[model samples]
Target chain A: MRHTKIFVGVGLLLLLAATAWGSDTDGVTQETSFWIGGHLIDTSDYYKKVGEYRSFEEDVWPEFGLTYKSTTPNSRFFFKGHYFDRDEMFGMISTKVSDIFTGKFRYNSFQRQTGQDLLENIEAREWLPSVPKGGGKILTHDITDPDADYNYNRKEILSEFSALLSRENNLRLTVAHRAIIKEGTEQLISNSHCFSCHLESKSAKVEDRTHDFQAGLDTKAGNLDVGYKFGYRHYESTTPTPMAYYEDAKHPVKGTSGAEFGSRLNYDGSSMPIDAKPKIEKTSHKARIKGAAGKGQFASSFALSKATNKLTDLSAKSWAGVFNYAVPISPKTRLVAKASATSITADDPYIDVNTFREGKPSAVDFDYIRYSVLDRTTADFTAQIFHRLNPKTTLSFLAGYNRVAREDYPVAGDGTTSSTIIGQAKVRYRQGMKLTTSFKYRFEKTSDPFVSGKGLFEVPGDALEPVHYGYDAATGDSLWGYFYYMREDLWYQAITTEPTDYHEVNLSSTFRPSAKTTLNLKVKGVIDKNGDLDSLDVKHSKLNGNLSFTFMPDLKWVLSGGVSYRMEKSRGPVAVALFDG
Target chain B: MFPFPAVRGDSTIGEIEHFGSLYTMADYETKAQNVYLSISGSPTAKLRLSSTLMYNKSTGEYDQVNMPDPSIEVSSTLVDQDFTFDDMHEYSNLDYSMIQVSLGLSYKLADGVTFTADGEYADLTDDAGYVYGIESGSLFMVRSGMKFDF
Candidate 1:
């Protein structure tokens, strides 16, 4: 088999070499174009800024991906693949605020709210927190204050696959599949989930997978050319039951009672007090439809293109479209205008991984909630104009507005149908070949009912027990505990965003200091302030610089190095309670 | 603060637990792809079977080392790092390889059930690392089932 493969490889290589040698630059000749490329990414701190216990740690590493393409003027095919593996150990310092959807509680003792403190210090250190008896009772924990030292460490593996195809008439198709599998949580277990001594005796594992596919086609009929595309994406996941020590006389102290306890609870083959379950296998199916219909006119100094687009939801058969036109008005002026309406409807299930890690009741099952299909219709229009002020200077301006009407079917809670209006304006300029700058501002206003799934703050509560009080055998006392269900306010609220703006300026130049090579230097800095109707102060700033030595152009190979520093912060007003106190 | 607390469900609701004497979960075996093979039993043939122990730290809770068997009759504690216990506690052999010597006859029943009786000798060795023991058992598989075309 090895020899057979080698023979095939050599034969193919020879055939390709012969074909290249035999080709002639003659009329009506057949041509084959070959290309290969790939990209590299390194995320040093992913999801690290959130959560008390850091879930993952990392070291600077390298991952290699390869892509190949062979094509004629009208037909082509390609394949690509990538793999990444690593062992990470770190603590989760802060939880992503989004994880509150799982109904997990996280209240600090000293920060308890006015009416929600339910457990004493010693009573608060058990496996699971207690809740009020009534089904509709809403308890809040004080989390207005921040705690910074919490963290948890985890290990993981990530991988991906991709392929592409291009048929006659400029038609193209691409597909990709990606997956991440997490194994070994031993390091994080000590601080997160483990039975004291038994911690050394056990470990936990988790797994996940995703797939994405896309297709694009373009063809010309008479003077009208059309371009269309569609995409699909899906994700699936699973995790087994993770156990800590069961309870016994020698092995006492249940749950995360702090790090000082000598022994953890032992299972001793008894029923688990908490309602622990594995990950709900959630699946998401996504489909997208996009297309452009237009005609193009080419000339020596300028070109113009105009088109109207139509898009539809295949599952629901509801659709809309926009009209767009781009024209080079003169040697120094160019303009583009676009307007369209879009509709969306779909059903997807989301998983709360934090619930599984904390061994709490998960909010991912069908019975917990079935998100009804959503129907939203949005209409927007934009116009952009650019001017070549001089041989070395250029300027561009942009303005746009959007309005959305959203409706939720089978509304479950406080969600409401409302409308929002959003608008933006921007300007960019380039001086000579060294300096480029841009400034933009955006604003939005909406009147809608908001439902915050997780807590922004809360006070801790009591230990969860069956209708009958359950006692810890070793302690010979009932387990009483409480943790705050962190929550943010949700109400019929009117909100606005103003001066959500940003500016970027970059300087670049290339100098041929030597005959053999030219060196290029570039530096850029940007400040971005963007947010939704709930808050207007989400912002970040970044400064970056790069120097490169281009050794070749035809072969397209360059050596470059760059570094970037960024700071991100968000500050919003306190959420006012909706219901009367 | 919100008016009513949201209700949540466990993600692992439909998962099956594998531990103790239970080799499979309810309704799980029905999905297995079934295959059948013919066998002959003879007195002169010799076979040997061996059993080994596997350590899975992540599969079960540490403090409760018994792997959470709600069906188990006794209380269970997590095996210490050394995996030692104060009492006569034992675990099932999840790792096993068998070789047997048989002196019997081959008889295939009309309804696809193959039944044969033969005297066989076998030995099993297990090292839970913390707990070491050597035990043996007979190999007997009575597979009686019907396959439908659909």
Candidate 2:
């Protein structure tokens, strides 16, 4: 709201000033433009998707623009404002002063419509009439506010300033700030199972904000340029967490055996907050240096950052170092090399869930420490060489290696590591100025790829045989054994869509038969597979093609057309557990 | 084995009779295409016209590959029913297409003055509706205004 007020006030001021000033006075020149218009929108059926990113309300709007330039001290100012509606608008202002200082400010606001899921497809029935719960029921949903419409308003403001601190040393100082705000209401849905397949939805208010600030200073020292930057970001949500009442777990139909059901649930028969957002703060510092080394140019940077969640008092810290160099081996050949390493450490928190079946005879403790997957160390190194075969042809080759080591992941007290080797080759040819073609091929081989630990399907040999239990004499119902024994021995491992081997190819061509006509074509393909999967042959492939043409046969007409197509396929495993017990 | 009536046992008869489930492979495929055309021209020194049309369509589906029958691992009488994996595909399937067209005209009414008008139309078709239902609709918007330069 503050940015909106500022935008309106500035627009009025600029309008008045431009009206009072002459078109040209002395060495000063000014241009001003204003427009007033109204737009109408008509929609049929569901309009949310049609007007997803726009305000569909029919309303009048105004636009204003001003540009002022002065030659005496070399200063220029530009401003533009478009007010479509209360929820949709854009404003921008940029200025240059004395060829030493530059500043820019921008504000934008838009509306987005969100959908509410009814969740009507979750239903189950018991076909056996002799069972305890003999009846069948359909899934039901309740909407607290059925007439409520879900939409959110997003607003963003960005401002940047740069100034020449020292002309002799070519030193510059820059500062920038950005803020984003989202405010609206959305539908919150929660479901409870085991007792009844019931879904409940309630309207929840959402008010979130994020702000970022950065400042940097750079200066030249002999043949090198050095710079340092500091950045801070904060995100907060002021909306109150929505509360839901969980149903007391029991038999779906008979509503008996409450204790058996209650033991399986961590919380029930009480109202608790759901989907609460956590406040976060992050800060980073970076230093970069660039200069000439021998007959080449080199640049290096070091950065460190830390982020914390204020709600939980948990924090993560990361540091990274990078180096890059480019040198010309000969007049027609050049080589570029880059290396980077990053390390991250995050606080591990202990989970304190209620002991499984707390007071029951079959109670078991299930609490454990939580290890973050974000705690990892990564390194990458790449070197590329470019050679010009002739005046019309150029070739480039690249080789790279990447390694990632995750700490206390998948299993506690053990770490998982993955490494990949990458190779690529590219060639470009130009036949005069009429046509240009380029082709690229890339290959990657990964070892010890990341896996999901215990989330995969078990091999037939590793799965424990089903246990048989006698029937219950009172109810005449069959007693079955639990599957935890089988689950504990499951030995197969599954990947999280990470490919162990992959190949990619891309080809593109541009043709300019004449100065007024041009054509472009591109094709890309990729295939990847993970052969180590025990029960699933994981494979993926993608293909894409694009073509475009532009023609300007005369000064009065210009035409352009383009088309693109893409296809992707993947084969993966989906495991479903049997919950008969 | 327990002899007491209603007494819980280490293993349930229901789980032992029906604890048969297997992981199956799913083939997921998606295809998308986009086309756009634009034409702009100045018929006269004081008049300019521009038009653009864009269309996009995408479709995705998931199919179970070599799904095994539950009866193969458990007694036929105990197996509740055969699951049709195809029925679950609708939850993840997608079929959507959208088209947008826009036209703009600008004419110099006088020195340092111009008139501009713009109109746009968009249509969306969601054939494979999921949780949000079918979001098929069409919208048209038109705006006209004047500009001045000094």
Candidate 3:
């Protein structure tokens, strides 16, 4: 293919050179140019295997295509053709319209065919149906064989009409519609050598329409600015397989058909499949904004939007918002921030719910409503300040505080509440280079009534009558006596401070060698001290580095590579749990 | 949750366990490659043509295994003398390939008026016949259409 394109280029260069060198002395020169070009490609078997015991087959048949494009500056057009075992076609046309309102109309047609295979000739080993070995491998279970092949024919005529009212003000509207008629399915017998007696064939019919409207507005937004566009599309497909003689060849076994395999055979057939209607649509809109920002500054911009969905299930909604802000932050600093956010939401009702009980009466009880032991709500606040110390240096500071509380419902008594305070600092240098250091001291205390483990009492039920009767030697003391010796007021005095205190320290650096790339090297150190536990000395540290690179030579292609390394070390107890009853 | 081999009791603490002799496991890994090309041309000064071709191939391996346990505990295995299993083992493989080609034409009558015509054909094949347990099938399709633009 590369060799062919090179040859074509050389031919075109020779033609242009001859035309320039062979010019007569006449003041007027008249010449006509003609050009033709095309390409063809083919590939074969490719495969990949896994797990030492299994194998796979991958193959692509030889297929070829070609195109011819011609142009004469003011006028342009082209002709195209393609060839494959399953399809073949040829067509062409051209036109030019720029001086005034212009339009075009054309007609095209083609035929499409499809075929299926013999299920019996296919193997069914581990599970499913199986064919007899060698000579008698015919399928008998299915009274009507699946489609072996079908053909579809399409014929369409299109026209586009548009007019430019004036040079400064122009409006153009385009509409295109297509019609297709597909033949119905038929039965066909295999070759004499094959055992299969017949196969089913079917066809499909399709109709579609597309529209594009564009309007140019030349107005002054202070100066002259132009903007315009619009689009629409629609499609429909139908398979009118009437309800006259529809019989399900298979029946449900354990569960519903297609849901379970154990009950797949239907001795008394009573099911069938139905055809569905097409539901696809789309719409689009666009606009442009361009003008001057301020003195000595210029600005130009564009905006576009498009959406698609099904009529039956119109649950998806998506949108994009973009803004470009360019202003001076200070006499020596210019700040430019471009931010865009896009979100999409879709709800699918087909999602299965495990709570459903088939064939059971639907009733609501207390068990149907789920409740939480405690309800809680928390609000947080955070802030960061960025300061420029010099042209190549900057400093930043961050502080945050949050308070959370868990209150038991149905009452408004003493509840558990926690509060914390955090602070950090950072410094950064020129492009892709920076040094960051931070220190955090958090004061967290929980306010709740405390009870000592030594002061507790237990009452025995009828099931534990033996223990109450003093038959269990493990608890020699009577319940009344044990309760008398318990201490229940260890925390009754005035409390000086809440309970937990913690501190953390961290330092790191980030570097970028070039645009579309980033690298980072950092070390984090932590020390956690708690007042609630006797041995509360815990420390954790980690050294980590990461590299990322993205290569987009042009908009058409992209390549990306990345890697990361981390080393973690710790010298402290991770967690400890205590339970008392 | 059918016959899940469970034991029920009302006591505060209770436990139940079961063991089986046959073990079944399966795994598969696959990779694929695809390529697409298209071209367009014009036969008449107001007519145009376009063509496209695409090919894709995917290959993978599958493995299945079943074996009796070499370790045992107090729980009894569910294998009986009359219940005989052959421990069937078969190598499974699959190959899928598809190719599509289309030719289209467009005619321009004026600055805002035009006509278009297109024909498309596609074929797909899965080589699953070599294995004892697999399905081998192939598909072929062709379609053509025309549209009026205004």
Candidate 4:
């Protein structure tokens, strides 16, 4: 609501009459379109809730969208909105007055229903069975909807404005507010290795609100570019905590306790006297400058910024500065270098605030507080040479060196400083406009005796293995297809990181013999070993094939399908869970 | 403390996902506060000082506006649900205050030499308990130096 008044004042204050529109006569053009569609899906009960969002695998849903756009030489306005069956909606509008200033607004919202909660309430006679899916009543009407619906909804609004000053200077301002409310279940896990331990959960709607604002200005003076930005953000998050439930399931507040104290499944659905929520405030200030030296041949840029976030008694601060310079040596060679430093300070990090627990000694603590003091600096220098050998063939080489924390102490983590040195070289050859290839190699080593985690150039090939061949092989077929092969041998050893040898190979090929048919197949085998002995950590192979055809391409109608199968074997710790007796 | 409502034997792993689906659609927040004071200045060249102060307080309850009316009295059962951890909840809120001060002093020891001293102090206090239950804190630092030219 405050943002609306601010934008309105900005618009009125900056509403300058257009010089070109006052005398020139131009016709306006507009375009408007609307589409409404619905789908009938054969519901699948297994699609309960997937990927942190309600699944749309079943039921009938309606969707509609409308758009309107007006265009002219100096002014334009655009609007669009889309509504879906799951109580999801999106809308945006923007207008430009005489091309000097522009204003835009956006709003988006969606609701997610925890179906199981509603089902339980209905079966237990706590709610009327007259409820429907896709965002509607859960009980007879709205009687038990508040609890049974167990719905989470979020709505956010954003407004932005921009203006041009002195042709080269520009100013931009943005303000936004978002709200997220959930009345279902929330998970709270202690910061411990016991992930499988009895998970802590609460059934309640914890509300959260966030407000953000930013303003920036950029301009060029003489041969120098200058810019600055300032931002402020605030967040209030209320996490649901375990509490009692009311005896009258229908009445949240005016009901007696259903379960006695210390009894299992005892909940009163009562409001907490004090909720441990995180209230955070953050502010940032930044400035940048870029100028040309050496008669406009050497370009230099610099930026400095500082940001601090305060949440309750904890406070974190970040400061950074960057410098970059580039210049051309001869017509075919160019050199670039960059230097940057970042530092972070925390008054109270995430550590146990209280060392004593009232009754539960083994009970892990979800509350923590700590302090951090860290600083890191990095520098990069690169030299590139590109020469046209003859008329059609060209060659290029790039050499660069990157250093991290080259100087100063690593004040965080184990109270030890670690430094990195990286050197790399790349060569690229291009022949005419048909063939191009490149090869690059890099080497990095840590200076500290104790360091862990992924190293500079180590390939983390766990997620996926990709390989391809037969490109430009010139086969008689419309498209050439080849099997993929990859062999990687790299192992790291350290006291802080996982030391493992990773080797993987895979093959994938796609064949499009005709315009109407397509086929793709891929298979991969992997062998990952860790520790001093090359013991197999994981050995798995997978095969996948997909086939599709344009049954009736001419009429834009087609049907196709595919199937995939895979298996894996591993020697890691046995998959375990916290089981109850 | 036994995981709150549920007893020791409840298999809470799977229920987390099932229950999370009921309400975790989005994240929302609302806040309003005033900056009490933030100033930095020096009355004279010999003495320099700076201090900043801020306060934040929640407006009111957002979701439950129509629950308690003059028509019917609020039942006593509602009051029994006030069970909560000591350091938990922000129902009443806080009148927090954070202040930091820094001072610098310099005096000439000789015609071409001078000694300078600098000190800084900060304090933060809030009303909330648990993780943010920071009652108050103060930090002080002092440094002295001498300059000479010949």
Q: What residue runs in model 3 are displaced by over 4 Å at the alpha carbon? A: A1-93, A99-143, A151-163, A169-226, A241-275, A290-315, A321-340, A345-581, B1-58, B62-150
Q: Each prediction's TM-score against the native?
A: 0.36, 0.90, 0.36, 0.48
What's model 4's lDDT at B99? 48
Between candidates 1 and 2, the one scoring higher on lDDT is: 2
TM-score of candidate 2 to 2 decimals: 0.90
Off by over 4 Å in 4: A1-25, A37-42, A49-62, A97-99, A110-151, A154-156, A168-185, A188-200, A238-277, A295-311, A348-369, A373-414, A423-444, A447-581, B1-150
Docking category of candidate 4: incorrect
Sliding window of 10 residues with minimal summed lDDT for model 1 chain A: A101-110
lDDT (tens digit, per residue) of candidate 4 on A1-581: 35435644454343223322322347767777665544433322222222124323244556667788766777877878877555468888777766466767776777664432222122111111232221111222112233333456666666667666666454334333333333334322211011111212234465666667777777777777777777777776555443422322221212222222222222223432233566777778778788887632344434444334344466656676666667666665555655566655556456443322224322223463343434344555555555555454445555555444522232344344444444445455544443344444444444442343322222222112222211234753332111111111222322222223333444444555555555555444444334432221322222222222222243333333343343333332211111111
Q: Which residue runs of candidate 1 sit more than 4 Å off their true CA positions? A: A1-202, A206-219, A224-324, A339-380, A404-564, A569-581, B1-150
Which model is ahead, 1 or 3, in terms of lDDT? 3
Better of 1 and 4 by lDDT: 4
Question: What would the per-residue lDDT of candidate 1 be over residues A1-581, giving only the tens digit for each residue?
Answer: 23323433443343344334433444322322221222122122212211112112233233333343333333232333332323322111111111111011111111101111111111122111132232222222222222222222232211111122333443333222222233222211211123322222222333333333334444443444554545444333335444443433221333333322212222333434232322322222333233333432321111111111111112332456656677777877887777777665444334222221122222212224445445666777777778877665566666766665555532544345444444555455555444445555444444442333343322111112212123457986654321122121211223332223545666666666444455665666555543443433434454555554533332223222222222222223232111101
Q: Order the candidates by TM-score, highest first — what do you get?
A: 2, 4, 1, 3
* Candidate achieving higher DockQ, 1 or 2: 2
Q: lDDT per residue, candidate 2, B8-94, as tens digits?
A: 322233322234356677889999999999999999999999999999999998874455665454343434544545576556779
List where candidate 2 sits over 4 angstroms from the true fold: A1-26, A59-73, A129-140, A458-491, A578-581, B1-17, B63-66, B71-78, B84-91
Candidate 1 is scored at a TM of 0.36
Q: For candidate 3 chain A, which ten residues in a row score worst on lDDT?
A: A47-56
Alpha carbon lDDT of residue A552, candidate 2? 100
RMSD of 4: 30.0
Q: Positional deviation of A130 in candidate 4, in angstroms?
A: 55
